[model samples]
Target chain A: MKGYLGIDVGSVSTNLVFLDEEGRVREAIYLRTRGQPINALQEGLRQLAGRLPENTGILGVGATGSGRFLAGIIAGADVVKNEITSHAVAASTLVPGVQTILEIGGQDSKIIILRNGVVTDFAMNTVCAAGTGSFLDQQAARLNIPIEEFGQLALQSTAPVRIAGRCAVFAESDMIHKQQMGYSLPDILAGLCEALVRNYLNNVGKGKEILPPVVFQGGVAANAGMRRAFEQALGWKVYVPPHYDVMGAVGAALLAREKMAGGGSTRFRGFGVADTNFKAGGFTCENCPNLCEVVEITCEGEAVARWGDRCGRWSGSLGYQDEEIRNAV
Target chain B: MKVTFPHMGHMWICLSAMLEYLGVNVVVPPPTSKRTLTLGARHAPEFACLPLKLNLGNFMEAAEQGADTILMAGGCGPCRFGYYAQVEHAILEDLGYNYRLVVLEPPRKHIGELLSKIKYITGHNSWREVIKGIYFGYQKARMVDDLEKQAHFLRPREVQRGSTDRAFKRALQEVIAARDPQDLPKVREKVRRIMGAVAVKPRPVLRVGIVGEIFTLLEPFVNYDLERKLGYLGVETDRSIYLSEWINDHLFLGLVRGQRSRKEACRAAAPYLNHFVGGHGQETVGSAVIYARQGYDGVIQLLPFTCMPEIVAHSVLPGISNELGIPVLSITVDEQSGEAGLVTRLEAFVDLLARRKGVVVQ
Candidate 1:
């Protein structure tokens, strides 16, 4: 059996998905990043190795995430894409009519406004943690509730309290105040859920024409409480796809499938990538005052890729080695 | 040789003082007056930011006055400041300026490369002297900054009773005449004494944070002297585009790795705001939060029209205001931005904040 593998290593989570030749997800693994993506990818690959058919040939491999550049080096990615493009493609593929996507991941949150399956406007909140899964995890911990049970607690709330959802500090104080007033844990949890949803809508969704067929993905979508909150706030049905957590990887695999079907040869390094020795080294380029700190990845002393350059100087310098290095594998 | 340094708000004053200490003749383009804007607007690319245009104008004016060298700083980041030096160098060269442009890239993973650039620019072969020059330069910059911040609070009230510009000019002249750091205290004392004598006003004023596109925020011509205009309307401004903040964020933050100062910035801004609203929205949130807490009437966030980071901040600010119960007005200005429209918005935002705070406009 021939198949494709996709890997997404974000700051918060690492996801790996396998798709058959027809672009159907055969299996997917989602693992917490826990500060190290290398180990997570290895473990994810080990699980996939167990699930795949014996003697299955991995036809193509693609990677995307904040760590896409790093993952591309590790997985020998045939294609690499930014999270925005990857998420939009995945959501569009799942809903076919997805006009808006609200993807709140473990560390970052992004709102993508789409018109006719094309992304028109998008904003990413990478610098703050207020509307992210990490924030929810922290709140769940503060409430002494198991993170897994948070959504269930929210679901049980008959009347959720209204807490200030703007800043995390105010939200925490408000949550504590409600708790002091003898509000039920479920009500507080639901309020926290609503606060997060309201914060996301007010911040990222501001002035945006967020139409229907809205798809919510990322790790946050796993929470039923958040989904309910979003539905209640927007007055529209929000769809949570079955494979919400690993949509980025799934989208990468889908993109690879489309590219491969276009008659162009796949640049995938194949399953043997797991066996390759890759090393990354960085050096400062003092060619001009814009001293670009360039990072280079080498496979057995041959430079495979170079990035982290501000100017295209270093990358442009290595343009000659592209075909030679790609053909070497 | 006479040299010119791009004005990074009050940092240019420090740079000038440092340059003077080095025995280098420093020519600062006059402090962002109308003529500076007229010259910048006439010469700058329409899409370029007001700060860049203003600085370019300053540099041009200085160059025309026989300044033979230009010193620019460099960085590597998502912020366009990293590329400003290279682009400005090309633009200046295109204008047929005969001056040599010296760009000093911040020392990143490599210290040796940074030292080389420093040696090249200062024309001082000794590393110790280069270090000392920077040390003294920083001291002078901080002193200048300290005085300028005081001026922001004092200027509007002094001007409210008339002769505000006169008071500021006299204070700056005293600061400029100081011989060294020790003399700064006396200079500051004199300025304070002068400001103390100026009549003070008792009405509440709107406080706005001018942020986004470093050039636009600092260059008066680009924003059409928005700060002065705001002050004229009894508005107090808190701008977050200080060179110190930029240096702390871009350079020092990285040196102390794993600390996540961006998160810290958000947390610090939390009392005033919640979550990152995008771009420098955190700073906008910080300013707004601080303004509201400090009893400032309103917060105005300014960005060059079409600037990506400010746009992101603008989208997030309305929600911030909604939550904080503080009013925030977002102003995006480009070449075509009308002075009349900006004045109208500023007047409305101030009135709104005053009404919300129950401050009677006397």
Candidate 2:
């Protein structure tokens, strides 16, 4: 009944994945973050605990995402790794011998080039939110259609309009202008998908050799229209693994599995932690001219972690909560 | 005249000590921060490079502190750095700072011209005193460089996390507070011992060379303390560009007595890049090849967003990487590169290098 848990808390969503001992996913939960990760995590954990079988044992937990440090502290994870590692790990595992990984998540998109199961190069979009899932969501809302339906609508387009995709602002205006120019919604939606994929290839995937056996994951990969565009853009078979949306969480679980030897126990705080009260607070440290804002998290009324200090004045002073024995120690 | 200049890493520490020693009143802008970047970005042309914006910000801050003169360095290049001084001067004048911008341009035209420019700061000091002041600055720069080098080597392997950083910071303070130039070498020796004395486990790890534009590579604020992030991930880092090395190569080449090595680096870079695109672009490629051939694990190219030279370097790096069989990661940062994203990429890079070698990162 023992299983490993992995959590990924990104700006747009929180994903929780449970894996059996054989490294196969048993359960996956993806929920909106809504700008508050703690609530989403707690709620996600609660739902997960409720769904588990009686006497089910959770062995190890791993966390990854933009909120990984905070998520790891809260989840009491055995390993805390970045989204890039998690995504790369998950993609490589899904498609053995994956040469490239294209992940376009809620807020950011990244290109990971791998060789022989090791990540060799990566690039994230710079300072512009042009080709990400959230932008897709925004466009869907403006188009007055459910985001889930938007991608399918793109598939119906007879001739997709060409929308400028260099910048997000430009893309939106172009989409509106196309809508006014009598282009069908499906055509416009398909055009938007193509624009985003083009943007991804030009910027994030720039200079990276797009070798075959490419695996595309992340929240955006759920959009079949985007997947088709990628296949055309790269002229290679783009494999969107079965669990496209929750790859980061799955990868984290796999990493946790690797970290745990047969006898090594996990740092998992147990499913009961879902009921525990966790509060986070922050204050700017005025001791120096840098004025660093140091944030601390309290679990059951005890300061467990501190971060965001330029010097170790704050983070070093506070006691960490069951920090990973070997990760970033 | 009370003098001030833009800050680049710890350049101010050495420059302040040297200028004060030469009897010129010095005004240092507040150490660069979010405020400085904001002020610079607000005032700078949107298309200008990050360093220019930062310098403008520093100059504005220094001017507010009643510094009447801007002592700046000048460059001539296909890169935009050489144009920084002139544009910044115009901006400050338009803002009515009433400051004299004294540029210490490179002596590509005449060595005497450079001498005359430096002579203004020499004042009533004897020629011996001027030489003494220059030597003193050189010693401090060399010491800082050596101490930093030692810390980089030790930090990844240090038994105590942040031990080398604390010791190095303490040593730098001693250097900054040093009243006599003669006290520099002793400080250097003492600090080197302290940093080198850090207890280390000496585990073999991936070695990464940071190759890119000079400003972004040296200034921790701009690159978000990249070296430390790599070090804590258990990776050893060596920078292709150092402020002291740049100074030695370009400004005081004769004093340091290095001519062959400069040509050697260019030659190393020549195979992949054949010609200099501008700034450190050639060095970035050359250093990667050098690191790859030397059997290093990988190279990370850090550049400011929209940096022309580094953009050229980025395009050429993968080809070199493919040819040499060493991996390269190019990280471009602007004002908005969040800490989480940068750290994630760095960790993933370290992970990649370690895994490729069949080494598990602890």
Candidate 3:
């Protein structure tokens, strides 16, 4: 096997990365999901497969992110892991001895505190999007500055304003208020970063032991403004991996490599999956008063996976062999 | 009069047992769901906790099905739960439901008062029979709790995945069918044997201690069947709150002058939170310390969004979570909590725990 394929289908972005047997990233691709994860995934995979060397044997596949289960069934992933694990693994693999990880994506932010390459504690944004990529993007668009230049502009600010960052709506309105008060755009952007960090610390990062050697990655990590704010707040240097945005996919591929090492046959249905017709539909299960909305995924007009059922009526009907997992303590 | 009560997880099982033992016609509100929540939210005041809305729904549905009297446990703490009965009653009255709302408050310092309240519900039971009925109800409550504990312990390790759940349902049905206390021993033995019969190949799993408000912790529908979700994720879930534990500590122990788990929880929580903040807030903090000290993997705190007592608990939990070196995931649930979003968080938390323990997660 020459390489392994990893797909990470998130709410805002779909990432695909191919890692060589040596666990080195060979190709990395990122595509905006825009509320259509399947299309984003298919386009990303097709581009990824087309770019790869001809006849490169793919041994195994892994899927992660919010849509791991869905992407796993679609891609025939050998290992379906969560984004936290994927991010932590990729962070650890990239920056050895990483003690903490801060990931802010489009819709959520997470803080994973690690001890000796193991994720010890983690907290994700719950019902809050204040310290996320989308919020930052919105702020940038509102300022009429390209998001790519917003960070650099913040770096030029001599006096940063303080904006409320506990809620996205309040933060946005606060930024507008700061603007009306004649604060420089760069200063407001810088203030936004500080507020975001404050909100993240007060919420998800609360009660966590964040040690040094912190690795910050995700779409938001591209912002030098946020990076500087983090340094000023925590007084610690934050390292961004080379393939930051695609780290989840990289971790997935690495995990796939680890699992395939156990000598099990690859579950990779091949790049042919990119061309497969996938349709998902949901129905309310009236078997009980709970009225669980069962989601069914069909490929080529045949049901391949079913979930969202509180009971095992549909999930148990199909016999899909998953990896042997440790008993939950 | 035909009596019913809003759902509180498995409390219905024990409450039903109590009513039946007292020889009253009992109608359980249909198991809580979207319909129940909608009806409750429609009638309940906005800003009320999820439990209040759920209970209201339960009562209305049960009333629609012919129940004329509603029995509910009332509280009198810093928590807003105590006044729920009065407000719910008014709402029901405004909704034009012809039903009686009987709020059962703790007798506090008197066992006689508690017994009298029971007599009031039973209508005409002799003192001796009331005692007998009380004894039977307590036994069933305990049995259900025990059976559930075993199910929690065994569900993740069951070789056939959901076979343990199937066996548990069967065992619960058998236990629920017991008409006499004597029948309990037989039922308990059968349940033990059946749940024990499931094959196990347990290596190790994350031991998650679930703590927080009593309502969301107990009512699966309210919290999206969190225990079941965790169990299927291959985690051992031990809830710190239960109806039996509540009755034992808050009611029985208070009146009978006996000790239960509350003292120990309070003791454990002393360093982090010395005073009770009302409701289960202190318990939630203390339970995390207790669970952490017990070598558990992590703790998950589930609370209704905007719950005061739980907010208090949430404030103090981080200190203990840090001091005790236990990872705590605080999940605040409301009516709009999406199941998929919950699953992702749970999966991530479980993955974090497994990775922490050096498990080769797939």
Question: Sort by lDDT, best first: what order?
Answer: 2, 3, 1
What tens-digit string does per-residue lDDT give for candidate 1 at A1-329? Answer: 88788888898899999998887889999998898766677677777888888888777777777777677767766666567767877899878989999999887788876666665556665224686888889988887888889998899999999988888888989989999999999998899899988888877776667889989999999899999999999999999999999999998787667546646456655555555666677898876533557888777788877865543466646764433222211
- TM-score value, chain A, candidate 3: 0.95
Docking class of 2: medium
Candidates 1 and 2 compared: the better one by lDDT is 2
Q: What is the TM-score of chain A alone in each candidate?
A: 0.88, 0.97, 0.95
Best by DockQ: 2
Give the per-residue lDDT of model 2 (tens digit) for B1-362. 88999989988887887788889899999888877888889888987778988998898888889998888888778898887888899988888778887888787645787788788866888888887877677677777877788878888888777787898888888778886876766776777677767888968777999999988998888988988878878888998876677777777764576422445667898877889788888888888888888899999998888899999988888899888988888888777667777777788888878888988655
Error of 1 at B137 (Å): 29
Of 1 and 3, the candidate ahead on lDDT is: 3
Residues B66-155, model 1: lDDT tens digits? 888888876654556567667777787887877787777766655677667656656753666555555555555544555556556655
RMSD in Å for all candidates: 22.0, 2.0, 2.6
The list of candidate 1 runs beyond 4 A from truth reads A280-293, A300-303, A312-329, B7-362
Provide DockQ values for all models, in the order shown.
0.01, 0.60, 0.53
Each candidate's lDDT (Cα)? 0.69, 0.84, 0.84
